[model samples]
Target: MRFTSCCGGAGAKTLVLVGKAGNGKSATGNTIIGRRVFESKRSLAGVTSTCQLETATLSNGQIINVIDTPGLFDSSVEPRLLATEIAQCIKMAKDGIHGVLLVLSIGNRFSEEEASAFASLCQIFGHEIADYMIVVFAHGDLLEDNQCLEDFWGPNCPQLLTDIMAMCGKRAVVFDNMTKDEDKISRQRKELLSLVEAVVKNNGGKSYVNYLFEALNMSEMDLIDQTSEVTCSEKSHEGKKFHIKYEEQFEQLIKMVELRLGECIMRLEKQLAEERVARLEVELKAQAAQTKSKEEMIEMKERLERAEELSKKLEEKFKNAENQSKEKASETIWSRMGCIIM
Candidate 1:
């Protein structure tokens, strides 16, 4: 079913940048705002530890509100702390989220953590949130000369990254944050904003809002009871047909969203388990190799010790034989001299 926009109209639009740590979410946010509003730097962990909101007016007089969020799937961050950070992001975007820029770096290999990123987002913000997502690949400067973004999506590209782009309706833009070319930067910014605008337009000029999140948070039982109440009220008001149909559709949509979200969560859990197993296997192989090297060294040392003992024994035997020969020669010489004197 097509999703109708629930909030935010034309004028200022709000976009949220989300991804794993060190993926350049903060850098992307800064690029979108046309200034260094968010603190961005090279780090193993995310530089932006909290959600920060900044606004800027473009040359065309279009105002954009960009929200830079802490790393969503950072391993170093505690789950509770991550949840708190997400809550802060939600609070900052309470008015509505026009677009969710899933910032990623083109230079880095798409990892398992990145593969599970969307599923995790689905778990937190509901499956429908994918409708508002746009994939923004940072570090476009890493792209070879004369190579376009499409070049990276060849057969060698990670399937997970392709899947994410497909889920986001193939809406993506490459940003060369390190580029100093004014025209190039402007073109990239325009392309990104164009995609965002297209999403907003497709959603009937409305943004994804907290209301949808609240509705998704409701239990199936709660939804059923709510529908029943609405049905009864509609019947009393003599508008049963319209209200009943709408409520039924809405209820079904919620249930579908919940089911999809559950599946996403399960898939994410499976991916994580597989990653852990793979990591363990690598560690075990390294340990086994180390143990084999140590055993080989010990065996070589034992061989050297045995060879040394044999060498010492052979040397002593040679010395004893030489001394015996010398004594025999001396006795012969003495006998010869006595004979000469007689």
Candidate 2:
């Protein structure tokens, strides 16, 4: 990550781009920088498989820092790997982000998986991410009859997009990613900058601030204090006029966070329960094997005892027969002695 602009602070703005694979996230980043800094090509998968930072001086005089990230919520990417990459992304936005461009393609299906990916930023980085977020629709040329984006806004549009618009204060912009016209580019860029300004003003001219990475450096008590501040700050800030319509949306985002957390806990508990059942099944089998061995040993001991008893009876009978033979021999010897005396 590098910042090449001459000035910093108020003159600068940081934006992060997030979306599913092949959703034109990289193209949006390129368009933002006024150059093809990121590779935009036809593909079924994401070209930027990791975080890439690029900076440029926009016509609006804002030094824009764009962090283009991979499809973090794509099914192909491992969750553990995605977590590491997302942390890297937050590190790049160390100064806090002024805008989060949730990119999506126009005239395409927004599946539930993609919707969750759209919502995951709030779920992972805390609901504060939504305060500075806006949806940018790529491939704007796909609209039929040269229709405007607003015309595609009502109930007739995809429900996911509608829900997403409601989440980000209905702050969205359209772009033809393939368009090379400088005038159109400048116009769209200004619209995007205006949206960014709204987010910044909503936060009292401050960027989106979160302690996810900062918490790693703080002590337990310090982290607790930080969390307390964040919780209190969330309650204290009702937001500026820019966010007035979306106040309830922010509240809903918090509730969504709680629901997501609850869902995670339930999944973990169910997993643990399944593991316990599997372990108990294994233990029961071992116990049964041990019991069978003990029973076999007892049966062998009883069979040995019966064999010994029969041997003892045979020995007693043999001894009695020997004694009777000896007595008969003695009587014969006495009869022979009497005959000799006569």
Candidate 3:
């Protein structure tokens, strides 16, 4: 891939623009640089197929380096190509990245692809990327005069968008790329730069550099050295030689990413299964306890009925014995009276 760098000096804050197709990432980059450095147009497929870097001085004379990247989740592009482009983007920002702009079109409905954008980025770049991320909503002109950026975050707002914003520390800004008013453009640029500055400050005045890339750079150098040794040793065929391109290295990186993603998915599935099993066990235990309670209640009722029947029988027998005793006493009294009379 062709890499371009121009007009960048020391302490230039580097910002990378990433998003899906037709989300105005290029336009956002252009807006940030206060110029049309990156191409911006409407397309069904995509305009940017690789990474491009351009630098511009802000109104305050602060040099800003903007890297415009191809669509991170463009369906039309192959996985290998996307991986290579992303690798190029990382290489361009290998020194350090001040902030990452996650551009989204405010007018477009947030779809599943867009919803998973941040998670996908995390899967590739690690979760720490969130610390340096700022969500930039493009096409702010679509908002009504009375509506603000918060208006889009009503009850009906997408939960994924809310999650992404929270993940990025709730740092976000809306840009009207179509706006030609110099005051509005300058204000938007200032707001974005302010967010970027905040990101730098929150990170202890340091830019983000992935350790994985550092490891990859070391591995690449080692590979190149090994290849050189082998080529020098091979005197049989000088014409047929082995060479390693960055594309190949990136392909390997992509494979590693795929493998890691697979492992995460498997682990998640296992956790979900375990949770289901635990929930089912709880339900079964509750049902068993309820059944035992009902059985104990029934036994207690039967025992009470039996005790009542026995008490009734005993009371009847006592009444009969009393009546017999009374009758026998009355007869004896009458006989004695008759004897006295005779």
Candidate 4:
């Protein structure tokens, strides 16, 4: 389905930046944004908890929001922290984010740490988020000593790079922030603009931001049918009947369709979990803040309110993931019994 916006003037674009910490993700944003909007540091968890939201005006006077996310691969932090950060970022950008710029540092072996990070991302955003994400290669200077991006990724960093492309569905580019090269930056900007244009065109000049969500519905239905088929096949085989398999598949499909309504509850839960973290972070920050200006105080207050809302929502999402995990686990058991195929 295409998204069409009938609004006129001042189109807004939100780009969320993500990566394992210290991959020059913030620097890339600073370069494109032409300022130090995001605080860049050498530490692993520099961005830490997704609080920084910067909005920059492009040459065309269009508003571009740069959301810098925390490093998901820091061993010092719990995995749930990353999930919480992502949840907060999305929640804060309810105005509709345009794209997710997934950055990777050049020359590093895209490790399992990265894979796990990607998996959590997939689980958080699900399959459909791929529609709004583009690969952003940071620190490309490391590749200067080697061959091109393709050769370097193809030889040493094949698997992770391949997995990233698969997650992004093959939309990506390399950005060398260290170079004083206009051509390189221009090329990267062009790719970013192209992604924006494509999104605008495909979504009918409106941002579908969550349209990748369409795939999730299909995936769930597929899971349900898969479960039902397994059950029917096992029972039918014992009863010496094959016709029941199709009937079982049909019934399961219907049940899955009916269960789609329950997804609403799951979504609410996910929001609750996110809110909890956001609230805690805000409260902690508020308590620490000594002398705040009027604007800072208002922002903190708003953050507190958002946290309350998210806490309830995150609780719900956690419950949803739990339920989904159980459903998949049940299907797995059936699969082992030769009941569910696919």
Per-model TM against the reference: 0.63, 0.61, 0.65, 0.54
Where does candidate 3 have its weakest 10-residue lDDT segment? 1-10
Which has the greatest lDDT? Answer: 3
Model 2 per-residue lDDT at 191: 91
How are the candidates ranked when ordered by TM-score, highest leading?
Answer: 3, 1, 2, 4
> After best superposition, candidate 1 residue 90: deviation in angstroms?
0.9
Count clashing pairs, candidate 4: 21
Q: For residues 1-342, what per-residue lDDT tens digits would candidate 3 score against the true structure?
A: 111122233478899998888889898888888889888887655688789999998767798889998887565566566666776777787767888999888888887676655676776677878898999999999999868878766788788787888999999899999999989999999999889888877777777766546655666676667566654457334223323355566667667655654554455557668979999999999999999999999999999999999889888988888898889999999999999999
Model 4 lDDT, full chain set: 0.64
Error of 3 at 155 (Å): 2.0
| Highest-scoring model, TM-score | 3
- Cα displacement (angstroms), candidate 2, residue 8, comes to 8.4
lDDT of 1: 0.77
Pairs in steric clash, model 3 = none
Task: Note the clash tally of each candidate.
Answer: 1, 0, 0, 21
> What is the per-residue lDDT of model 2 for residues 1-342, given as tens digits with 9 covering 90 to 100?
111112234578889998888889998888889888998887877788789999998654669999999887675665555656766676677667888998888756777667767656666676667777898999887876668887775456878777877888989899877887889998888899888987877777777655543432233344345445555456445234224533443344434444554454455557668979999999999999999999999999998898899888888888888898899999999999999999
* Per-model CA lDDT versus the true structure: 0.77, 0.74, 0.78, 0.64
Q: What tens-digit string does per-residue lDDT give for candidate 4 at 209-286?
A: 343333333444565565566654485463443345434544444343334323433554576678799999998788
Q: After superposition, how far is residue 258 of candidate 2 from its true place, in Å?
A: 18
Compare candidates 1 and 4 on lDDT and give the better one.
1
In model 1, which regions exceed 4 Å deviation? 1-9, 210-267, 274-342
Models sorted by lDDT, best on top: 3, 1, 2, 4
